[model samples]
Target chain A: MTKKAICFTAGKLAELGKENIPDELLSGKGLVYSSPATLAYNSPGAEGYGVKRAGLAVPESVMLIVAPGCCGRNTSLISNMPGYKNRFFYLEMNENDLVTGKHLARIPEAVTEIVEFLKDKTPRVVMICITCVDALLGTDMERVTRKAEEALRQKGFDKTRVRPCYMYALTREGRRPPMVHVRQTLYSLLEPMQKDPRTVNIIGNFAPLAEGELQRYLTRAGVTHIRQIGTSESYEDFLKMASANFNIVTDPEVRAAAEDMNANLNIPYIELTRVHGIDRIAKQYSAFAAATGIEIDDTEEREEAWEAVDALKERYPDLTFNIGESSNCDPFELATSLVRYGFKVDEIYATLSPERFVYIKNLARLSPDTKVYCNMEPTMIYYDMSGSKADITIGKDAGYYCPDIPNIAWNTDIKPFGYQGVRDLMNSIASKLEEGRA
Target chain B: MRGLRKVLTPFAPDQSGAVSVLYSLGGLIVVIDAGGCTGNICGFDEPRWQGAKSAIFSAGLRDMDAILGRDELLVKKTIDAASRIDCKFIALVGTPVPATIATDYKALKRMMEKKTDLPILTIPANGMRLYDEGEAMAYRQLAEVLGEEGNENKEESETVIGQTPLTYGMDYKDVSLEQMKLLGNSKIIAASASGVSFAESMGLRYEAKAEPAMKYLTEDLKGKVLVCHDEVFGKTLRDNGVDLDIATFFTLHDSIAREGDRKISEEDDFTKMVLEGGYDTVVADEILRELIPDFKGKFIDAPCFAISGRH
Candidate 1:
């Protein structure tokens, strides 16, 4: 009569098919558990580069969170971090404001006041972050931000731009979730500029991608100026992102913004998904080389990545892993890659989407009995990690569940991509496992 | 400019307060929001969440769910979660979404009651109000729903109410459900402003004092001081010979309020008080020092997790 967390084996999931995936495995189907894995998804501002941090990705930009007091409550954690001081402001909506819809009117004045408060360090952009209350109200944020810009103009601060950053949790499952919309909002600041064929912008993560094979490949291909929002030193430098001839989209969340850039700024883009499988990484590079008409000799990088994988395999022949979604790599894809590397993946904590069923299908063929637990399932409250056979855990959430195990939280802001990611991740696992033995 | 806060982040809201009070109460606590509210509660506001596990959850309300007023769906979800978890009761904590939609908690409670055998307690705490109000509401609901009558003949035991980590930080003392149920027989010590409000509302005789703030009584002699925290903390200091005036961001009950004591709402109010009030020492969370950078005064760091999320 003891309680247990709900989970399904990879074989059972593949047998049932994506269409019949259990409601417990899929997101937005039940009461979401407040697990550490779901914290970034649930409260975007609490950890990582969620809507709050993502909205402020533009250099010299500040955010004005317009929501009920609750929505902005956890932002104090973000505000306390370095480089975030005096950046976050709030306009708390009371019950009267909710009913009267008068809080929207005050937003313009609030923006003006915030701009005035930071006189010497005036922001180039003020991102007005709105929440579920405004989402339910159907408030036209575009119009509100326009009014705020006009108010600033009248105050002789015409240079400061006002933009809307939707932190709407209600529209999370929609086509443009908060993360996607924030990217579009950030990229929308890019005005038409003279295109530089040599300059390619990395459009995805707010933090700069790790200096690895991708950057080296681009550098060797005669691309002199590679612009990423995180590397941009100033607001003026960030504006130069518009000058890129094309963009390299690293994250799927940034595709909408890349599409916007294509339509408006005339900057074409090529997407490179972060995967762990060494063959897939090489295949993606080959596709990149063909598309860009630049010869990519990835043989050395591929061999190095394989060497790292083999080294780890030799060290821990039957090493097991428990991967969570809060990490840089896709939990399913990472699990599949780990299984293919001749290692056992004990469990994967991630949401099951139909698009990711390919990984699950691959995992089913390799590791049929590997359990998949949706981090957001209500039954996760009873998650007893005593049953986990993982020798080591990866991602912050997996570490939280398995405190006794050696963990490598690969969820850093600086992303790891391509073959470098594969090699680095394998080496990190081996190092952590070795350290555990020591 | 009325609601604009350029100096400070928003303090703990009512939803966080409700969760703090009901967190260790062995109840299946559900915050009625899309997800962010529950995230704020678990991820930031509730310090107990770090090393412990609580049955706190989000209703996982979608835009369509709110727009369409899917009350039945919420009821079904609650019942489903209750069936899976081991809990003594179910508490529905409200946030901005329900407030915006004008959710009738009484009816939701009725619907949930019909579906499950466990007792249901709904706190209609819109995210608009501060944590003190939410804590008071939870205390009121807990007393009304669980307080047993005909306990006047039983031996009296004293229980501290409203000393949650949000207000008292690591020094928070939790009140159990067993203690809550026997409130009618217990002599209550209102440990905070919320507790005072709760005790006052229930027409119960109680002593309002914060035992944690008693440490400040032995501090070095000071000129006129401004104490900004829970009303009970200020009252406790003042009662113990501290020459201080209360300037609380939270509720300052008339009973605890002196002639000079004020209930401040915004950052400017605190700034105006510190700069213009001519006090020698300012006792508050040091995060508020950003507001009165020009004021040359002795500042005491009384970390209130509600104001500044420091432990």
Candidate 2:
């Protein structure tokens, strides 16, 4: 028997501890943070949620942004919000700081200052944000925060709490990126809250949750209290999310966070990733309703989606499908899905994720010789561009490389969430194919 | 098998590293192309181009001839050109292009002394590879190569780096002068365009961009006692105090070394501003400690890491 072993050190994993934190209350509650990569690389122009979803599921108002003058310059979209304006602060460092590492002491001080600023109108939580510098300097932000918290508590400040939040671009693993990490952090916070009857927390906002379809599905299904993180009307409104009796993880990245909530708070979760076809999406919704004991009538939405797909099929019977992007969504699975709808997936440019690898293995069991190309490798070489039958491609940045084929930009930096994702995808594809036919 | 096919097919074409004419900072436009130039380590396989009539007359030059500085035909032509160029003075650009041993240089200098009276200067022309250090090293080497000049009344002017083909920009030059004036009390030759070449060669010293190249160099010359105690101007400015030093051109290198400032070049400035700024925000604190063993102070731009690569 081969013995399995774990290689990670406890010291490394336990580096973020209670004592090292600035505010125990903030950690006790929950917080999330995110940072953009300065120089980023995406496979063949694939969209990335590494930075945007770094702190996806945190109760919004509790988060604080910490970065250098140059690094945090682009986060104005977040900071300019009426809710998040006070949460952002900058610490300007120059060339001398890089070599000498003198900036380590300021971590706790900045945390304490931000907490104090929020003292008068303090929420039940505060999340201290730290970016990539902490990684390089190896500054024990948790310890520094703890020391600062102790100092602050002694100074007669009470009822104010802060916690350490990290937004690292280096650790993103395909679909399991920082946005997933943020959701896990937030779910862990909502775990302790008393569960409400018949309510469910939506765990799909690790990236932006498409509102139109997801909202309509929840409403039609009679599912109440649907909470989206990025589309939150108010940051403080995130506190009311604990009332949900259950949760649905529409994106895989939210699994860790959902699991944390389930393990701690007894809020069981069901993973229902984005499905892009009407029948497949309806079946997934029916299965989810059966598991959760909820009645969901997706009949109207399904009919609309089917009509749209049929219209697209009528116009482009010879349209060859090419999905070009690096993603966990298996091209073989997509091909099978399209086959059910009477469409041929001629060629695909994609990379398999660890999560999707099992699907491909199963796909090999069904179709012995399916042609799949890695996103980085050019498909034009193997399948001659002149003779190739591909008329439409679905992915980001594929049009630039393949001008012969018309492309639809359905790829995004957000995790496509839920059965609604399937509907949205169908709508998107239909529109593109129709437009191309015209 | 698929990966092997991808690699071995040879028909698969990639344009990722295709060479293009890129115009960047500095006055010179460098055209860099791959798949060429391999005569670096071993001796050249092909002889020098012999198409010219003058080259045909002196085709039999040898290593021994170079070492002894006795290639009469080559020396005669060089001397004739030096005397003939319509200029008040002539400067020699000594680069790795035609590398000779130190002994060869001495022999060549001796031969040139015996043969011609024109002012022949030699300066290194190492292209930009190791950042600003190349410029600084070349400038210093050029000064030493020039040896002692009888006319010591050279005008006090700062030679900016970005002025000619060997160029960067005025910002580095300004920063160089700022540091020069701050550390060395003398007026800068050209405060805006203090090229490293003139400062290093002409016995005039200039400050580097916020990197510690000059400071390290100055400190290394402690035997001469030509440096003053090191203090950070940024620190002094923060505390509202003046920490001053007066260094002459002869003692500039020593001053830099004594100051112990690592951010004496533009590369340091760019790194600190862009790369380090990103690192300080994203990575965990313990990880940072492990990576940067020599850390002391607090985080400089924690908030800067939030946005990234903009400010």
Candidate 3:
């Protein structure tokens, strides 16, 4: 007997209610399949700005990953990249170290060795990345990092700061996941400085956000210095982020960090979610204008976004999509927005959460029969894409699954957001579809 | 500074090696980890995972699950997955989480066996050990659980053991389950350090030679050449008239070990060897060149996926 991939329609999911969501749809319920979509979530270091990359987001920083050899194996992919060269070091833990917790003792010496080894390229910060082994052992990393700092100080390198970042996959479902924790750890480095009204820091996203109306909107409202960690030139330049009046949080994962900033540095924050729907973008911008007392007339940008959508619609009037969670945009929101634009969505590959049920409910109203496949489900091993009628696929994982279909891996480190994101995505789809036809 | 690695990232661990062996063997391979270990194996370690689908999964053990030592839940999850997925057998590969908790693989295997009729192969690979050890363990477990007694009627074919992508890179040729079952009767070839270890452990009469390394045997060398890869690769090169010394991070069997042939575990060991060996030519993965940038030696490129993942 042939087994099939398990899938539920948006309507069926909406009817099931969030509390009654199937175990297969929600992650952490069963064994997780190593699908490409799940790789980003499963192995945080595999793709994008995971704990390893995010820890090094601070300018002039190097990381020392202290864990079992397996934890740091995938880091070679990141290490080989041009930007990450000479930045990553390792302190591999063994069985004896696991038992005695002696790796913690060796970290200070290891940190000193790494700093001495990288003499001329002396780092302003050293991030100590520990994995689940420490998470299980309940190792006091904060004290260990302080000890490392003191060791550096005693060695006449007092300027060097040491910090610990957790790569605890076991605590992924907990309140503070590794991603969320890393953001907090990075932002916590910012010391309180005199607030500048013109300066605003964009918190979240290790890579710079796409040049769009979001930055333009802030700049048009008399904002002079717009700082982002990705665009910061040096350690001193990164330190200037401490003077920002407020933070504009782009990702939800960074909200805890934003809260920390609010408490520690007295920097207020405004959260803007990355959405695909033009209406939602407009509403979010309007809300932003109202809260910050910054008038954002998004009429031109809104029309431009809709124009791009219409242009794509004209070229492929009955275009259908297969969306995956590996993209920048939420699969449910993107699916719902596409359906609202009179385009068909055949399938969505993503893990479901109760917080995302609102989008699923909205999607049910627009596209009831759209099948939702959990990318991490054990049954996804049998996922056969032959029956799908998707003309195009969005996201890297979707591209992997549907090789024949024209795909736009909109999962670049450079994020897409707001009105410009919608416009760029629409044009990208049209361009890719044209390329496919050619 | 015992495990401080400044030049190279850590190589693929035992769990990854174990998975690499059992990847295509018609089994539901489950890594007893909290997603990251499984992700590292599929995303980085296992080159075959790209564009290929396998039944490899993470047990998805949470903090409480590991803290409380929930073996029954893991067994239930495996049984549930096996019910839906078509597989000939089931394999449980261990990682740091299991190692930290001191997970009893024997107990877990016994628990799963009662619920499901499928044969269970348990590889207790702590993530601390290197890939070669894990591969040898997997090969040993496969032979113990699946190997059949000598058959009089069946035709004997030479089965290659431990020629996985982790060791052979692009030249990896898989040994199927049927071939693995005939280990007792068929002639065996130990393809790498792991193969040699497995062959010796099982007391199987086998030819110890790396067929892939035979390609490097023809390279013209001037002076003393230092070959750093799997031990058998170096041995194969030496047998075919290469005046070389073997320095392997993997295994160095007594049969393959010659004078000056060292078993290295750190970056400094390799650096010291290259500096002191006085070799005119060094043959290893290009990634190792980062360690000895000052060494003025002719380097011959030998891509070992386990060392550099260059395939």
Candidate 4:
């Protein structure tokens, strides 16, 4: 008899709806906020996720950061920010609560307490930020949030609505990971308002923005109507987001949110990631202009960046460099740009993040013999000249380990944005090298 | 516990009027394991075979001709190593790779020791069936060297077994080194040093076994007559048939340092009275209540949770 093999046929996967945007924000009636886990997983960055979760709010808006205590302490840095100092609140969990799933019950109580605390000013919305613990316990935060909202309604708080936002670092594979999901929650507040045909909502965390540089760039690119989430715009501005021709997603993690918006609002999105090299960044802008069919003049601001990079390279042509972090944007782009400007990228220590892997593959094609190392590999110790040979190192926390060697902490916390970012990176490198020479 | 059981099996004492003790023993004691074998299969007693100290030359593989897989080098090295050492016996061990390769360590050991005029022992590096199997192997090997006639010469000596402590401290915490020093300073009778290759290295034989001024000590002391050997330091409560006073104090005072709500005087009182009262009361009460005149308590009961809060 012939052997028969059992196999399953592929079926069409169901599509999830775009994040619900509330009309209050679009109508200038309230505010919308969003937060994200940091670029790396675990450690202080995990705690930073709570800060980002709590800080994404309008003036007088209340937000709750629900996370384990180990991951809760990182909020101190976010609390130091002048704009979000008092708007955030934290709920810390103990090891016992983590295992027993006791913290799940605390969510509704936390929301009620914050809502009551914010009673003086009827908060347009109260967002409850649930971290990865909910993912582990399989806690249905939406159901808990509904119960919280109903309880609030019974207490006569009609205007204040509660929303559930997840910060699940473990769920990075889905079409809507927590990063994009948090953005959806923020934009959901603006869904009730009619779309303003001319206005567009920038769907990404504003913490990475260089002051007002994002709005200036969009304005410079001939888009008169532009609004960034967590900026001056209210929650009402979000409903008008559908009327815009497109959304510009500055971060790669928000690509899924952009796609969800693309499917629902019919607003096309342009992905223009942040960069630290002027010519390459300016080239990226030109590419964005080409894609959007919008024209952008090469203002004097662009020329100054080019001049700074040129002067820095001319002065220090023999500079040896090491790239050690995997930023959201392409690290290989930074590596190649520095190498293009006559610097030897001696060593690179980064992870094989799927998004960042493309840059690494391209770098491999360009410099096949260039020594590359993974973060977990034991060989990283040798990169310090005292151990191995590296003139300059870049990226997160690499500076801490290689303090004796000249280091440029180019990653983590430092929001490398716009044309000025390119100049700043070059200047920072030059300053460190000059100090090393002395 | 097999190692411990093997320890208890009444060996024909080499010397009389001496007692020996060992801790949680009785089981297979296999070594030369990789990270995969943990918990019980492998133990700490590996040979110090690093660099040149490895028993290569004395094991007599000196001829350089056997490196080509003649299998003769194994026998030569085994004999040569045993002969060079002061010991009159050998216990050759195979590494994990050698065990997997199924190299004939047994045949090689037999061939080598016969030529060298000394006894050789082989220890299985794989599955640990029980502790007794290993101790039995060790005892049998020791008997072959010392023999019944040789044991008759002993006047007085005790053989202690197992030197590992209840808690192992490896430099990562405070007081670890101090604790190790305290253990080292104790009146140690005998110990099987980790990484001893030749059989004699397990322990040295006293030339005058019938010597009156000799005392044999076991490396570990678990279930033995609770006696205080030194009175200056403390009483040998072993002779008095008493163990640690469990009720006197659950823990020492240092555990409360830096605690936020610690009441020093009250805690100190609780630590003392409880430990003394509990241990003495429990042992005495059990002995008094027993219906059988010769009732024996084989197992030592310890309260594991007692020190949880104090630490």
Candidate 5:
């Protein structure tokens, strides 16, 4: 099983037709086989570090990752990442613990000791990140965390709280992915408070959004205080998240947490997906404005976004781009947008998510010759690039399959939202193409 | 709840450790569960995976396929992958879902044998066991399934098995220094990710029970200041005139840290002894050398996989 993307020409994909192409992503029919590409897909450069890496976003809060030593070994590398030193702890399980489930009993004491260990400052929360071991063992972490909290209180650390977050990879494709659940788990820390309509809390991204049009638009809409979990200066500032009048979920993963906030904290949220198309993004904003009674004039942003797109078209008029599924935006929709802009988009490498179907149908109608491929498919290793005409690739996974090709590892910890996202992507692609020429 | 983890990231399960045995070997390693098991191994647990070139895929067992036993699908996919790559063998590793559902691996192996001529070995990794057990099991299975029939002359293939990073950090260099001459003709099998000797190191640790390695170490060693890990020390150091009284052993695990009189509870214990005890020679992991501000002593860089965990 070579771990490369399955290479197929646009003509071949067109022949196969959209109806015949397997919906392996959302359908859950993952094509498993021997793999070398799996290595690249899971590499740190590819941002393959799971939710545990993202879950540690809360400032000053420590994570006690309970699993066997094997599971915790990688954290040593992660622990070495800036600011992670000593913030991550472990309560490992052995053969006896795995069978007798005795580790659960020791967790409270472990929490107690961890709390005591962090004497310099009383951490706001202790996130208990559990894995598939508990999924199989069926350990009720809620009850377990309740006991752990009691132990923390027993130790007289009244300022802190212990909460459970599931890292059950087995349940990743279930109702909510592990990253989504972790978002909810992190936000669940905020207790209900009186609404401050002037304040807006942004949930979803672990990294703070760069200063963009959105911040100015929010300010114009009378949003005086914009608090994002990643940008929150302190635990107290995070606690003040409950005071936000509404939540703006920049990612789908955090939408579940937004729903939880709406139910538990009485603060409603508007969900917006990051897209490259100026019109699609503008329409989404209009929908948000209609829903929330907030006027958003994205004319300047939209015009600048088109200028970048048109400039790219003028320079790389005959460019054939390779888009991929592993990036922040939907590869299918991104492909559709590129095709619409008259720049050749002949190849797309992405998993078949349900939302993909919307863009897939459109691409099939407009750009029927565009080839669709799954990165996880076993046959991807035999992807011959000889016939597939491609100049630049978009995502890391796509770049991985297309060796010797200029690729923008567009996936990042930062949120690239709306018209600014389009402008940024066009500039990045243009610079990369110029570098290739030089 | 029978066994749920609250805060702990899933430890390196047997499935991941099992992957280590075939690390450098040009073999197709497939974890039969879902994406997470494979992701956990390739992404986090196995440090050698980055910039690596090995065919390790997850069966991508969907909820329905898992609910209903679908070993045929896996067998078909394995054949397609093996046919594409030049793998020496195919290793099928298991996870929690297969064990809970009781997926028959033996039958799956038979089906796999029908499709490809390459040797197919199944590593029993149910996500329930630790890395040591999984690794030990992988070594045993590889020895039996992949071992070639040989003549009675054992010297021809003097292999030291049961070596891996799990027990020994990058400390094998220090450990090997003590017995360089002793293991000159011999080669380490699977201490860590070395591309040879797929057997495990625990065989040496538990050799006293029945194996001959301990007996071999006993007759050769004269009384001298020795520092070794706890796992192998208990068995090998128990030799006549070679007990813990003559040796200082360091171990992180409290349960197996003791051998007669000597016990090293913490890393500081090793630091204190090495500085003051004035030992003539030391046999431990090379990582300890970094802890000492400066060192002027005889030390063997031994790599033990068992004690390579966070305290």
Candidate 6:
């Protein structure tokens, strides 16, 4: 067996130099590609928030993260992030409890105690986020949650609910990523209600999808009650989501949960991938309209979104860019869209998925030397584009990697979609580009 | 029920503490687990992660790789990573899954040693215990590997060992310097022990982050007089009393085999030792007030990460 010398940790090709590279380096041969996270990977990306922050997207939902000491330690920093301080709770798993499964029994009483303590604004759902320790112990959280629900009912809080979200990092590389499982779990709580054909539910994301063009489009189509899981101000509002005509799976990772809801509740869903290209956005909107049999006249908003992008191009022609992997925008698709707009896309720091190959292959063909590096690769520590001609950068990860450069994080907690998303993104970059390093 | 932390998260486990000791030493540290362990360590617990270049990685352990007991794949991925980057050594920190399956890390370490000359250290951290335990084990393991301690030719300046965020909080670097500077007049280099009580000896400015990191790295154990924090700092402070040492530990058995200061077994014992022993000041974390109620001596606060989980 020949020991092939290929870079596992990410490094710039220019830094490695051409002469040191073997001729068979880029050859599609018998090799395995892996993405073990690096320092760059630590930057909060879209894989989903920390366990403490995940289920808290709902108005009155609190998360109880159960693991050994180390598993819950990092949550302190995340606890300080906005909207997360009061909602997160923890249950530490010590050696004896883990070995004997003693902690599982305490979980029921613990939930009841937390509910009673909250006294004023009782939590609608208590999300028990289990970590890898439980995965190893093979602890049945489903049974544990059921027991907690029954115990809570016994305590007179008959309306309260308990659900489990798995933070099984071990299965991150498996068929269903952990975040996908989390989305499925969060949305599964909405039980079937009487059908209301005029309503639509925006599935996925904890950050509210508020006041976007998508909402306006739905409103124009006689969609009276548009609901989002993350925007529910009360448990009652969240429960009302079951009456929607159809579910719009706005985030790609939420498709699994949407499918589950469709199968179980007979509430069908249409998937929408957030994209930056104006033409592509239009096509997606048309497809969504066709799927729902609702006529959405979004021509004014679409033209306005394009006008914003065109204004930026006119002011700054042949601008070079570096796109980050973080945020709602798909890196490959976004990069390809930027390239198609006659913008000089310098490089992209993104992880490659099999579904994104079309964009990657097209990107390679259009800009042959465009570098594609995975932020999770350990060698990303050495990513230095000091000599590059790119004037501005996009995305938080990109901003960090290419420091001292004019960049835009372009990151908002709220889900960005459709024509309004284009306006928001382009507007953000345009304003930040003036400041250069904001 | 005492240190339960029902609402607050556990401060950190021993594995993360062990990783903190070696990460700043400029090596490619890989936590041999799924991604979350690495995330918690680098992203949260390890404060030096921001604005620093450390080659830490997750093994990206998947379901089958773990289920099948694939040590070879770990070895190969590690080797591939090492070949691509420049690292002095490799520390494979274990998580619960590997420990449950009883992954033969020593065998894997031996294979790695055979493959290349990189000094391999395996911290069999099962993610069950707290940070101080991990720091203690990692400190000992790394000491054994690189314990070429001979000041025969080198400068015998006053030194402080295990000076990192594991022992202190975000202000570890500043606090460590302050502790070392207090010992500047004395003709000794203070090599700090692993646990939070060692920080207490500096005066309880911080809460004990966790249980002590192995009682002490004693004088008999290493042929150097490892005196208590009080005996050295206490003498200089009669009028302008500077507490040279305030020796207290989480567990009683952790007391070092030094002569000068007696071991403080409980809160009352701590009070008696201070009042009768002619100690003018008590320096400890403010969080310790819950434990040590009758603190009559002048209080100088030191913060500890272990007990400050509510903060």
- Candidate 6: CAPRI quality band: acceptable
lDDT of 1: 0.90
TM per candidate comes to 0.99, 0.51, 0.98, 0.52, 0.80, 0.81
lDDT of candidate 6 over A173-291, digit per residue (tens): 56776778877887788788899998888887677775788888788888898888776778888888888889888777888988888887888999887888889888988988897
Fnat of every candidate, listed in order: 0.82, 0.00, 0.81, 0.00, 0.29, 0.47
DockQ ranking from best to worst?
3, 1, 6, 5, 2, 4
lDDT string, candidate 3, B57-78, tens digits: 9998899999999999999899
What is model 4's DockQ versus the real complex?
0.02
DockQ (CA atoms), all models: 0.79, 0.02, 0.81, 0.02, 0.24, 0.30
What does the lDDT read for residue A326 in candidate 3?
90
- Model 1 agreement with the true structure over A1-438: per-residue lDDT tens digits: 359999999999999998999999987778889998777787656689989998988999999999888888888777877899989999988888988999889988898888998989989999999999888888999999999999999999978999999998888898888999999999999899898989999989999999998888889999999999999999999999999979999999999999999999999999999999999998999999999888889999999999999988887899999999988988999999889989999999999999999999999999999999999998898888999999999999899888899999998899888888988898888888878779
TM-score of chain B of 4: 0.32
The C-alpha lDDT values of all candidates are: 0.90, 0.39, 0.90, 0.41, 0.66, 0.64
Angstrom error of the Cα, residue A36, model 2: value is 14
> After superposing candidate 1, which stretches have Cα over 4 Å from the reference?
B153-155
Tell me how many clashing residue pairs each candidate has: 0, 93, 0, 76, 45, 27
Deviation from native of the Cα of residue A382 in model 1, angstroms: 1.4
Give the Å shift of residue B277 in candidate 3.
Answer: 1.6
lDDT of 6 by residue, B137-241 (tens): 675566456444332323334334444565446534322222233332322222234533333443323222222322322222221111123222222121132
Candidate 3, residue B38: lDDT: 89
TM-score of the first chain alone, every candidate:
0.98, 0.70, 0.99, 0.76, 0.92, 0.87
Q: Please give, for residues A268-345, the per-residue lDDT of candidate 5 as tens digits.
A: 988888887788888998998898787899999999999999999998889899887667678877898888888778
**Which CAPRI tier for candidate 5?**
acceptable
Candidate 1, residues B1-311, lDDT tens digits: the string is: 67788878888998899999999988999899888888889998989998889999999998899999999999988899899999999999999999989999999999998988898999999998999999999988887887777777243788899899999999999999988888877889999989999989988889999999987775653998999888899889988888889999999998889989999998899999989999989889989998999989789888999998997
